[model samples]
Target chain A: MKTDRTPKIGFGIRKIILALVIPFIIVLIWLYATMYTSIPHGILPTIPEVGQTFVEMLKSGQMKEDILISISRVLKGYLISAVLGIFFGSLIGMYQPVKELLVPIITVIRQIPMIAWIPLIVLWCGIGETSKVVIIVLVAFFQILVNTQSGIESTPKGYIEVAKLYKLSRWKTFTKVYLPHAVPQILVGLRLGLGGSWMAVVAAELIAATSGIGYRMSSARSNMQSDVVIVCMIVVGIVGVLMDKGIGVIFAALTPWRKVENENRKEE
Target chain B: MKEAKDEIRENDNSYIINVEHLNKQFIVDKQPMEVLHDINLKIKKGEFITIVGHSGCGKSTLLKIMCGLVDYEDGIVERNGHAVVGPGPKCGMVFQDHRLLPWLKIKDNVGFGLKNLPKQEREEKVRKHLEMVGLKGFENSYPSQLSGGMSQRAAIARGLANNPTILLLDEPFGALDALTRIQMQKEILRIQEEEKTTMVMVTHDIDEAIYLGDRIVVMSARPGEIKEIIEVDKAESRKRSGAGFAAYKKRIYDYFFEDSDVEYDVEYVI
Candidate 1:
């Protein structure tokens, strides 16, 4: 009799294959459609043309410079936003008076779109990297702030009561009990905020940038170089995926309980 | 009991806790809701005492008061001849829920109350406690990964890791299913035998009280107070099928069922 399967192939690898299958099929269809169909070449850039364009951009060194500039701005903006968001969010979450005072203000500010802030940001910081960074920071800060506040507020009463029972120092309570309880929610907020900031940064750069990927896209649009624009868009998408994956990895590492549960479920 | 107190006073170091006329009340919507009223109890060193009552009998509140988690309206709780102020390293509590920090490993959760100890010493203490609790191999497992019984074991291990003078357990077995609860009880008995630490556990389950406790304090509901404290001398002889166990269970059940509002009190004991 043949031996049963070892079950050692791993579900994660299978999941990756499952995820890629449809996308790969779609790309194949696109290539075949380009080869056989009468659709205008201008409207549907062939797969190889897009690939060639991607390689060209990589060789020019222009893509690297643009990517670096965009990334640097995003880093600064995201860092500032993360610090401010956690600080204010915790403040509002902790004290009732502060929450009452600030909740309405935050609710109002959260409603305003990042694009709407463009004119005001331009007026205040001028149409430089500063304004783009400001836009990114503003977009990210509110999302994280709101999320952090909610996270802190939603911690179980049991945990806090336990902490109090132990007479844990205030700092220890915050670091050990409250922070750990609120981490998953805070991370969700951060992930959402990261995506929001990326979108806002690109928009801000497109409208007023002299350098970066957004600047390249704008310049490409002006010259009617749709291929370059598409290339830039793909880069943006790839970077977004990578950044999200990076955050996800960190989140999984931080919460091993979740990882174990997921692994168990997959086995089941 | 009076003579036992006199002997304890003569050798003050033997008694771990002395409670005198303890009372606690809460103001709920301007009404003075009394919880524990005119309570007096004493816990000897290296003894296991269980408090059994209905849900509203304030057994948990009494445990909290003893641990200094809540303030009493009147009376005094003394530990080692010193009036209780707040919770100290000498008293560790296990709640109905495990309350293990989800982010921490089993070892870290067990070691949480040992923040003041040196790192190596804390690790050793944690490992020793885990081994005693029969969770030696699962030190890195998270609370979420463990079964309900396992989690409670971890919580028990955490309580012991501090090397506390007393372990205050409030319905620690309540969350487990029947088989698991029985297994946990056996494990706790083994640990109690090994550690020889004082334990005061609160439960609504009479058979559990009889099985695990040297003395079971039966409590009355609403403005809660101790009705009677029964000493189970032949606890090992009082098995589930034994006549002694049945008699004690019936007595406690009849006392609670006297109110008529609690219909299943007798059924719960069986």
Candidate 2:
């Protein structure tokens, strides 16, 4: 009964309609530009041309292959970065010596752009899968690590003092106090790292890879198939949104206490 | 009250806690300043000792030292007949802020210090203490889900879950509103009676001190010296409107205003 009085924001079909308003306007603008303007088909594909190309790509299975290739690369790099980042982040965050030893070097290394490392990575590992994976790892690791580190480091001293009072071992303290406190923040890092890995893999493919959606886009660009390039861009955007939402759902499940806190704030 | 306290002392010469020449210093603005100076006190078993003082009076520091949460270089601070090197199961502490982990459910937070216990026993203890604190239905709730008084009740449950011989409270109810604080005070006395645990509470509220303490340790700030220790008979001091309560309040106010020209006693003319 106490929860009944709170004014709820729309999350029904109305909310979905509200969300789609901008996209609908964007499509309308695209339709108007393509139909009325004298812009060349190579520069900007007409609406019907884009729709036909999207249908053609869907029938050929080339689109599926390209999307699958890009997705798989993103997954591989994201998993590696998550594991290593959390491990080393926990270490560096917990221990002063580890932080002192790693942070300075990591800080300098993180400043180096992902694209700038492409030439060197491709030179060492060639324009193959290894270089792409390496590129994604280089891009994603710092995002995950830095976020995880700050999250772990920001655990309140009060909680640590409670852990100490209980006589918990270092590992126990980390697991019970620091880890739980940092879970939401770590998820934020993971989400950011996922986005970074996706971007990095695509960038790698554009520069050197013979596969993926990025490669498909670049190839389409070379052939002046602007409609196919637009299709690839749309797919990438949709996939990015899906990945973000998927992680968001998972993160929500992981920290149910946060939901409780929000409800408690309403009670207040 | 003096005769009763003396009788208890005679019955048990072994004090539960003994603090001798306790001196504590903290570096404030790059200068070593004394916070507690040559403090000495002895606490008997199952005694409720309330410390009343101004803010920054080192009463909290003194309580922390007794709990073995803080170290002292030059003083002897003993708990359960041993030197307080660090926090142990013999002593538990409740802070001003209810220091429950926000992520933990009430059950988990209360049972936090009971990690070494078997699972069933820990759950039983957690359940028992939660009921004792009147938070039985809130076992699954997070700390943030509870109101301020409820959070404090959970914190007290956490403190008592260890089954410590002594519980040290550093203004545990200071953050609560007036009505809730009074309610919690009554509940604390009931819990203390049931548990028979020795408690040392540092508070600024004189009424709370007088109502709860078997003996009140009045303290002055700056050097953080113990001004006086007044024994209270529960029957009289517990009655807030009674003459005995006013007498105790006046005595405490006089001690606070002794060196100053401020006439704390006021006559209201209507």
Candidate 3:
């Protein structure tokens, strides 16, 4: 058995090495261009210079504070949108009257982009944390609502018959049948919403924030500190990837049935 | 009709289910189409009845109406002297697709119908039924993890877990392969004998109808109506290859081909 598994393990490792090769090559080219060539200092900083700036930001605790503020904003906005989206989406999905009443209005509002709302939100709530958070909320809310509605509407007819035959109550049907069926789609919406929240936070901070990664990048741009800007960009990309992976883990944990379903399909 | 009434009245306690003057219609493309016309059926306690017809014969719809999952225009369906207004705990149904919730484990799926019971009692009943279906060790497995046959078994377990008086099955083995279908037939027979639950099943397979049902209800398409009801006397020891079984098969075959618009050419090549 041990000998039989060796080729599979070797194949996985080889694939990982292949995936990393392109990024490694690009980094090498970047290092050569910045260190050896005369590309001017302000245009593009060397990798080590950016790395040094990152270390200094960490030591001074400024990066930590900005990151915390941005993350807290995302959390608050995302939580509110997720709760309301699921609640109202389910109502609209299950009831035709509710859908007819609210869908058109929500669709009209959703057509207006999150960035467009920044001006009005800033005017209403001022250039404070409320405006930035509201912008993020608007960015995240629509995706969750649409996904949740579709997910609920697309529940299998067979499952609905089961619910009817068992005479499940309305609440029980929602909790047991509809909720579990919609979970994967809801998670998809959540992942998309998180990415949107990150982008919106940066935009909001750039427009009207006292302190955040977006503010730091904008300030660095004004001061001609390209290294600081690069450092902030790297930090944001890393955090975004980590958050996505974290949600992926939760998705796998919640939907254990999907694993067996994919395996059955493969066998077929 | 008078004979049926007398029979029902004579053994009021013996009949577990009684259906009379059942008429069902559906609106298709703004046209009113009658599916079942003035149908009547009487099922005794612990009886196994199979309704066999071709596709679009409305046999499934009839079963659904009996299970209270569909509404009928004119009918009186009674179970143990009480009218069946809607679905309740007394009747359990196993669907054609083995509609087990994909998110739930096998144990929870089986125990789903028994949610009104106490926690300990529900778990015990689920365990017993799961063991009955030969799925003792698969309690934690999801429906997707099981084979088609295994999933059908789980569905049967779920239907019986409530210990209902009557179990309605709508082509439960229709999707299974031939071998698995035969095995499921025998498994259902064994379960019916052990539990003594009345079963009303719909199937398009004649052999399945003859092999399992105490009475085979043969129906015709185009506003589906019962053509005949054949009684199987030797339900205890049925032999598919026996001469009696051949006779029954020929009788059912004639009903479909004798007066129907369908034509057959004996010498036609494949």
Native-referenced DockQ of model 3: 0.81
Which structure among the candidates has the greatest lDDT?
A: 2
Every model's DockQ: 0.50, 0.70, 0.81
**Per-model TM-score versus the true fold:** 0.87, 0.94, 0.93
Residue pairs with backbone overlap in model 3: none
Regions of candidate 1 where Cα sits further than 4 Å from its true position: A1-52, A265-268, B1-15, B29-31, B235-237, B259-270
Top model number, DockQ: 3
Candidate 2 residue runs with Cα over 4 Å from true position: A1-18, B1-4, B7-13, B259-263, B266-270
lDDT of 1 by residue, B1-270 (tens): 658756865775677888899988988999989888888888888889999999988999999888888877589898767888888888989999999887789998898888777889988999999988889999888777888888899999888887888999999999899999988888888888888889999999888998888888999988899999887755543487777877777778777777673575546455
Just chain B of model 3: what TM-score?
Answer: 0.91
Between candidates 1 and 3, which one is better according to lDDT? 3
Ranking by lDDT: 2, 3, 1
| Residue A109's lDDT in candidate 1 | 88
Q: Estimate, for each residue in A143-177, the C-alpha lDDT of model 3 and write its tens digit.
A: 88888999999999889889988889999999999
lDDT of 2 by residue, B1-270 (tens): 678767867653468999999999999999999999989899999999999999999999999889877789988888867888998987888988999999889999999998668899999999999999999999999998888999999999999998998999999999999999999999999999999999999999988999999999999998999999998878899998788888888888877777653455551110
True-vs-predicted CA distance for residue A166, candidate 3, Å: 1.2
Predicted structure 1, TM vs. truth: 0.87
TM-score of 3: 0.93
Q: After superposition, how far is residue A71 of candidate 1 from its true place, in Å?
A: 1.4
- Minimum summed lDDT over a 10-residue window in model 1 chain B is located at B261-270
